[model samples]
Target: MMLANVGTADRIIRIIIGLAIIAWSISAENLWWILGAVVLATGVFKFCGLYKVLGISTQGSTSK
Candidate 1:
């Protein structure tokens, strides 16, 4: 299994923000759903590819 670098709090916030953005984008007929998808993916999976590339992790040691 792959390690999850995203912390619980961060994941929650991401999901909330992603949903909000997606809702707003849909109402405005924009393509921001792509961004929402990325955010949701990272939060759901508890992993962030950009975080890994930048060597940044929010997860605690025990979680890793």
Candidate 2:
């Protein structure tokens, strides 16, 4: 299983951005929704594969 690399703030921002992208994509009839779904998944799961690979973690010591 992947570790939690996304912090609270990052998660919130990702969720909002993901939703916006998804909504816009639907209206525009584009394929950006796929990217939006990935962003949303990372936020909802609190884990980021890229962050892990890049040795980046937004999570604070106080968080789980």
Candidate 3:
């Protein structure tokens, strides 16, 4: 299983931004929703592939 690299605050922000983008996409009929979905997935999963690749972790050491 992949470790969580996203912190709580980061997750919350991503979720909010993702939802907003998705909402806008639904209203605008654009493809930006795909990006939103990706962002949402990262937030929901609490793991970011890019963060993994970059060796970054916003999660606190207590969780690890």
Q: Estimate each model's TM-score.
A: 0.90, 0.93, 0.94
- The residue ranges of model 2 lying beyond 4 angstroms of the native Cα positions read 62-64
Ranking by lDDT: 3, 2, 1
User: lDDT of all predictions, in order shown?
Assistant: 0.91, 0.95, 0.96
Give me the runs in candidate 3 sitting further than 4 Å from their true place: none
Ranking by TM-score: 3, 2, 1
Best by lDDT: 3
- Sliding window of 10 residues with minimal summed lDDT for model 2: 55-64
Output the lDDT of residue 1, model 1.
63
lDDT of 1 by residue, 1-64 (tens): 6689999999999999888888988999999988998898899999999999899999978822
Predicted candidate 3 versus true structure: per-residue lDDT over 39-61, tens digit per residue = 99999999999999999999989
**Residue 61 lDDT in candidate 2:** 82
What does candidate 1 score on TM? 0.90
Worst 10 residues of 3 by lDDT: 55-64
